[model samples]
Every structure is written in C-alpha cells, then in structure tokens.
Target: MTAELGGRIREARIARGLSLRAMAAEADISPSLLSQVETGKVQPSVSTLWAIVTCLGLSIDEVLGHSPASREPLRVEHPNPIQRARDAPEIVVENGVTWRGLAVMDPNVDAVLVTYAPGAASSPDDTHMRHPGTEYGYLIRGELTLKIDFETYLIRAGDSFCFSSSRPHLFRNDTDAVAEGVWFVAGRAGAASARSAPGPVRDAVDALDAMSRLPRRVGG
Candidate 1:
C-alpha cells in the first residue's frame, strides 16, 4: 500500500509535469509532505492525499494503478498471449521504422513508448504543431541520436531530455542495437484555448500526417 501510494503520487506528478514544490504550493502542502508522499516515507492521510490528487487533476483509479480485479497485471501467467505483441499495429514513421503507441490521448498531450531499429530515423513533423508546452523523453535502453532544430543530441540509457514541442526534430537509431524510449507530449488545457488556437491543431495534424508517411519498422 505504501509503495502503491508513492507510485501513484510520483506518476501523477510526472504526468502533469509538476515539480514537487509547485504541486505542494498548489495543494497548500509543504514540499516535505509531497516528497514524503512520493518516497513512501510518510503516508498521507486519505483527505490529504485526495486533496493532492485533486490538485493534480487525476482520478483515484489512475493514482492507484488499479485495473479491474480479473484483469490485474499477470505475474506468472499460465499461457501469456504472444499474439498480442504480434497483433499490435505499428504506427509507421521514417527510415523503415515503426512505433507501437503505448498511449494516445487527444486532450492535452500524446505519449508513447517507441522502439527504434538500427538505421531508423524519424520523419519531420510540422513546426506549427509545435507549441508553448514541452516534450519530455527518457531512454529506457540502447542509444539514439536526436536532432532538434539542427542540433544533434546523443542520448543513452537512463538519460532524459525535455524541450519545446515546436522544434523541428527527428530521432535516429544508428547503433546496432534497438533503442527504446518514452515520449510525453504536453498539450493545451482548456476548451476556450483550443477554440482560439486553430493554428496549433492544424500544425499537429500536418505533423502527424507527415510522420505517418515516413518509412517504418515494427517492434514488440
């Protein structure tokens, strides 16, 4: 339960891109409390934790990491479905590469776990799709080269990068091994903002369409 609470708080903070101090201030709690909550050092009362979760705009189940009982994450399954991996459709991109979107959301951001094969490169997305918010990525394994606005960044396992979503960027895997990473896209929050900003929407659509046209390969 303590581990669960910590995971929930940490996940919420990361998903919302909030610093501990920032979230603490928003929830009218101290940074110490937030840290404790994230580390499972000090369990927060139900009301206190609820308040924090509310400030972060996450549902209880999302925080708790609970799926339906029957569908709980399998530890030692009798017969796992390898077909699920074989059947998961890949969203093809550039250089004979493909991405299996782990998560897709139309609201404020789009995030995915991407695996890149050797010689793979990303297609350029529209700059107009770029916006005020930022994109964050963490390399889970292997090596990759990220080119953002003409600058190349080499990232490896345990490395992370955060930058504006508006940059004309591409990722390439030049190594012999496969590269796996997570991408989190920050999106607009309010309906009024969306209504007022058709430029971003157009850019995002164009960017995604362009990406879809690139060469792609699949990984499970």
Candidate 2:
C-alpha cells in the first residue's frame, strides 16, 4: 500500500510537471516533507495526503492508489442480500440475472450486473428527472433490445455499446428467460457503496457495467 501510495504521488507530481518544491508549496506542506514522501522515508497523514491530492487536481482515491477494486470478476465471499427493484419484484433483478458487479479504476464509473427478465419490456424513465452520466454495456447472455435516443439495437450476447447519458435509453428483456449483461455507468455510485464491506472484485465490475446501461439523460 505504501509503495502504491508513493507511486501515485510520484505520478501525480510528474503529470502536473511540478517539482517537489512547487508541489509542497501548492499543498501547503514543507518541501522536506514532500522529499521524504517521495523517497519513501515517510508516509503522509490522511489529511495531508488528501490536501496534496486535491491540490494536484486528483481524486482522494487516486492519490491513495486504492481504487474501489479491480475490474475483473472473482468468487464472492459472504455475499450480501440482493436488493430487487421495487417496481420489478417478480423480475428479480439480482440473483435470477446471473450477473455480477465489480470494481473499476474510476470512482465516477460504476460497474453493474443487469439481468433482464423475459417479457420485461424496458421503459424509459426520463420524466421528472434526468440521469446524468455516460453509459456503456456489453451483453453477457441471451438477447435484448438497447434503446438509445430514438433508435433500438437488438444487441446479442458479447456485443457492446456506448452512449451519452443525456439521451434516453433502456434494456428490454426480449428473451425467453433472463438476459444477463454488464453495464458501466459513468458519474454514478450505483454499485460501489462506500458503506458496503469489501467483497469480491466482481462486485465492483458488475456495478460498473450495470451503471453503463442507465440512460445518460433519462432518470431511472
């Protein structure tokens, strides 16, 4: 962790093309302290590190080099109870979907596990609110309809799509059973709740993928 922190600090500093002295001044810390951190002679306190990260135009997680998790699926240990959508209780969005969420590199990006129930025609919910973020999804199983703007793509398993959140979109469960897929939502925290315990890397990735399916403009 310390090594990752050091590397992140170094990367941030270099990206800004700022010398240690400059960074120290911008971060309101002593140059000696910066040098010590760079040399791995000392680790900065959380507050100090956050200040440095903010001054360097980086996120708190990025500076710490402790992203939510990797963007790869893994075995789950002590999995939490699945939360089914209130509107689609019979649809069972969680377990029946055969999908998983995982962590990714960006905090603003959420990975999701989207399982579409058969005959579950997706409806755009852009009324009263607008979903704000970019969206992208990849089919993991079965077939489904991906609505973007006014066009619909009959995306099949393994296919992928990306679009802005400003446009309305929805996933229709046009298959005979559940259609499994991954959606990555931008600028939303649909999956990685800071409150949740550290679980499998797959959770993070799945949440990101699910989020990607949300409409950029429509609020769902």
lDDT of all predictions, in order shown?
0.58, 0.56
Candidate 1 per-residue C-alpha lDDT over 91-180 given as tens digits, one digit per residue, 9 for 90 to 100: 655344555543232334444577778876664332222232467889999998887766888999999999754444667778999898
Judge candidate 1 at residue 45 and give its lDDT. 85
User: Which predicted model would earn the best lDDT?
Assistant: 1
Name the runs in model 2 displaced over 4 angstroms. 1-100, 121-130, 190-220
TM-score for each model: 0.43, 0.40
Task: For candidate 2, write residues 1-220 as lDDT tens digits.
Answer: 6666777788878887999888787666899988777767788897567556545545455555556655332322323333334312112233233333443444566565666667654432322111435678888888987666568789888899887553445666666866777678765443222223433323222333344333322112
Point to the candidate with the largest TM-score. Answer: 1
Model 1 spans with C-alpha error above 4 angstroms:
1-89, 104-106, 124-133, 188-220
